[model samples]
Target chain A: MNKKEQRDHWLARPATVKRIWRVFVALLALTVLAQLAVSIKGYFGLDGWLGFGAAFGFLSCLVMVLFAKGLGYLLKRREDYYGGKEEPADDV
Target chain B: MMFEPIPPALALLLGGALIGILRGHARSAIVLLAPLATLWLVWQVPDGVALDIKFLDYRIEPLEGSPVRRLFATAFALMALVGGLFAYRQAKWHELAAAHIYAAGAIGVCFAGDLITLFIFWELMALFSTVVVWCGGGPAARAAGIRYVIMHLLGGVILKVGIEGIAVHTGSIDVQPMLASNFDAAMILIGILINAAAPPVSAWLSDSYPESSPTGSVFLSAFTTKTAVLALILLFPGEPLLIGIGLFMVMYGIIYALLENNIRRILAFSIVNQVGFMVCAVGIGTEMAINGAAAHAFAHIIYKALLFMSAGVVVYRTGLNRCSDVGGLFRTMPLTAICGIVGALAISGFPLTSGFTTKTLISQAAANEAMVLVYFLLAAASAGVFLHAGIKFPWFVFFQRDSGLRPKDAPWNMAAAMLVFAFLCVLLGVAPELLYRFLPYPVDYEAYAPDKVLFYLQLLLFSGLAFFLFLPLMRRTRTISLDADWLWRVLLSGVARGAYGALGWIGARLAKALMRIGNRLRAVAARHMSTSPDGRRSGVFARAWPIGTTALWIAILLTSYVFVYYL
Candidate 1:
């Protein structure tokens, strides 16, 4: 298959959709749970901000992964980041 | 407690030497026995008993006892045991020999009563560990071993200077907390930081670690960096710079790990990340935070070594270290895959794992201190841990689109090591008190309340969500991300080349000028020395005639002077 066809095939797969939905629900549930936990723990004289911290942490990771490609553009090197002759040209 | 006459440090050094002198299975036997003996000695030391000696009008306490020291000493002993088991089967005789010496160095550092002893053992650790790396036996391993030696030698020098300065200034060599404002303390902190794989020298870890023999990496992962963490907790707790430096390490490790394709390299970066939590905790410097750092180091050695063991097994069985070259091995190496996943989960700080039990105390300490920025950065780092190491490692190595290679499960010894650590990880997570009894602080910290568990589970599970949601961004294959060490390895190499080229250009010009001058001198000398029977300088005697005449005249003058004096 051509590159475009391969990309389209992957994006359109049912597994892809299922994976996306699973992640989303899991994230939402986690955020709500963290918020509740932090509030309750805070009331009991445990650290209060944990729930918010957890929620914030989860959100940021999502954002980072979402933008990882762009970030990779800046940070990623040729697979030959070491600039050695042994590095395969197409590996990256 | 009765004060022991024998020094633990001396015993360790002697044990290490004895192990090196032995051969075959005797080597492993000595390795195991030495640590057990050292552990016994460490446990026997009473609280507040210190071995004090006066030198150069300065008081030096080279041995001090506290719960913290005991905790670190215990971990080092545990590491020696497990690391010995993992390496005993596959390693060369010298690797086994060097491994004992290396473990001795670590144990010595734990019992080190003062900066002097600590520094001595610290350099010893560097020296012997380099020997372990060299045992991998390849050109790459050789080059890596050189770089590793250079980095550590530099660290040792800095530490020595710091120790001497503290001795001169304070008239005491006791290892105690020092403010970062003190130059001696700062020097010591930087020195230790370098060993801890903190930036900008962090590349030494990933560079040398993967190049080590599969068996050697297990030993490589345990000692040097974690010992540095132990030192930091003892000396630099509450230093604010550590907070920022550690946070940078956390994200840097995660990002680099995300970009890496080698299974072992991924684990190496994760070491930096795990140590970051300890460093941050030390910076917080609360009792709870210090407790967290100690607990985390204990848990980290077990889980991280387990992770490396799993990766080593894969590489050993299949002869591949790159993720692209490895996949579908779960079909055959199911046990290794499961253990690897367990390690990944524990490392990610999933609830009901050792990491969850230990890592949260540091985060809670930060939140309690109201360091919002640190709290956020650490939280983000937590998620990144899941992204790079948690999901990414297992997903690519074991479950990624099958590369259709099946290797047998790890050897029985390797399986035994992995299982032992995997069991410890869960056991500690589920029943933290087993490990808690060994912490530096009282066992008041709770790792698994409902709310806390729920919060972490949600955070990590969602982080996993983020990973899949951006699957397009997380594609893996063969690659390595350049880190700060690139400045030394790459940028410095380029600069050196530029300098060499400039020097070559200058040397060519200088050589041409010298050649012309030399020819002129040669012609002049030939004209004078030509043998035309009357040339200025013909034979060897002719050339020497002027010197001979001068000598004769001087002799006549001396005779005249003697005659005049007699008259």
Candidate 2:
């Protein structure tokens, strides 16, 4: 909302956000590359392949999100689907 | 011995009673002291049937101790202590009391050596948990509590029927492992599955748990499902059906949580998913699998509660439950955010967290059995867990688009509680034996092998990648995703209303017909009996034709009868 507030907030800066993403991507790359140093024996034959964890994990999550989105078509309802007024947390 | 063997659950039960009667520092002391006392008592239980009673010609083992029993009891007691610390400053006195009572029920269920004893404590859990849900204190909470109680009570009745059937057939009620090979065992499995938050009935956990008060949910998440996992391990180990059911729950929790908008509900669904891993392990039924199940249950209780605590703090501060309503909270609430991230990491089974060491055991069990499909599915589910709970929760609630709402962080007690659990999550992760030794079986498994660590790190980090990559698909909306609860909440209710209306309509027509028939009969009788002798259509009986004339008719009839008798 103000220049001082913007400066104080680290995430508010586009440059800082870009740097964080760079680190995250680098971390992802390192994990994938570490497989070259350490051979992971898999219980199933297919899982032992290079980058299998990354491929499988990424694909599984992708499929699951898609599956959930499809399910949302059939099941999603408005927040007031139960017809009661929503209340704030009881602590308040 | 310095002390007589007592049921460890009593400490919390007594504390619950005292909290209701006491006030101020005394109440606070009891709130904090009871769970610690229970934890001390839990360790005191020897490895056997420590106490028993006879009822209806049956021996009931009210207190039994085993490694598994003690482990579950320890977790319950610990949860009560930490949860009390989290809530005492903010929650209503009765809610705290009900929560303690609820924790007592879970602890009670842990040490029960016989089916009857287990059932008693099982019902105790069901009863007081409803009170905790009601502690949420709203129309939604009230309605959710009613639904929750009805489901649990139904499960309890089914379990009772099965217990009775088993007792009648075998002439014993000992808590022994059995398969669902018969009607009795099937009933028992179904009953326990309901509590395990297994499919069809699993919706109740997601439905009611999030409706509880922020503090109330922290307690609610720990006991009921984990205790059910304990019960399943004790009674129905090696049931193959559980493998399929557990897998379903694993996926079910992930999908629903993915679609969920409310931060608390997402965590609630994750409970089902995590419990799924335990259930699946129990079905594997090896010593390794059983150990894995027990250890996972212990780890799950800590991290899941931590997640709920962090979410509770957000809700407490911002008064917002939906993820869409608030973001960028990591700025103001660094402790809460870091604790939540730790919880998220632990839940994801990241290499350095509690979930990693414990959950890997279940996957290893599947691998040991050469159940290739089960192992792969479990691995994928682990990834799914990270996607839904591990990343989705913190992302939406803490780090997504700035909602410009800056709320203060958790209060001292809450933060302290989170810190303790967060520390335990890492502590167990770094040193698996701290938990592994307490497993019912010996631990030969090593969680920190180089290959295993790399494998999990890759899987989880990649899942994290998928999360950010598919962020648009996972955006929060002001909506809820329906589950099996819809059957009773909508379909069954609609059917019930229709049946009631039909019955009312049928009864009304039947009453009208009966009245018409009665009127016809009355008309015929009046026409025959009320006509005068002169044909003047006078209703003599109805109008009360002179008392004298009536007496004269009576006399004539008596005279005629006398003449006939003489004849």
Best by DockQ: 2
lDDT score, candidate 2, position A75: 93
- How much DockQ does model 2 earn? 0.74
TM-score of chain B of each: 0.91, 0.94
DockQ for every model comes to 0.25, 0.74
Q: Could you give candidate 2's per-residue lDDT for residues B248-362 as a string of tens digits?
A: 9999999999999888999999999999999999999999999999999999999999999999999888888888898889989999999999999999999889999999999
TM-score of chain A of each: 0.34, 0.84
List runs of model 2 lying over 4 Å from the truth.
A1-5, A89-92, B518-567
Residue range with the least summed lDDT across 10 consecutive positions in model 1 chain B: B533-542
lDDT of 1 at B511: 100
The digit string of per-residue lDDT tens for model 1 on B455-532 reads 666678778767776776777755566577778787899999999999999999999999999999987776676665
Residue B119: error of model 2 in Å? Answer: 0.9
lDDT of 1 at A32: 70
Among these predictions, the greatest TM-score belongs to 2
lDDT of 2 at B527: 74
Clashing residue pairs in candidate 1, if any? Answer: B62-B113, B63-B113
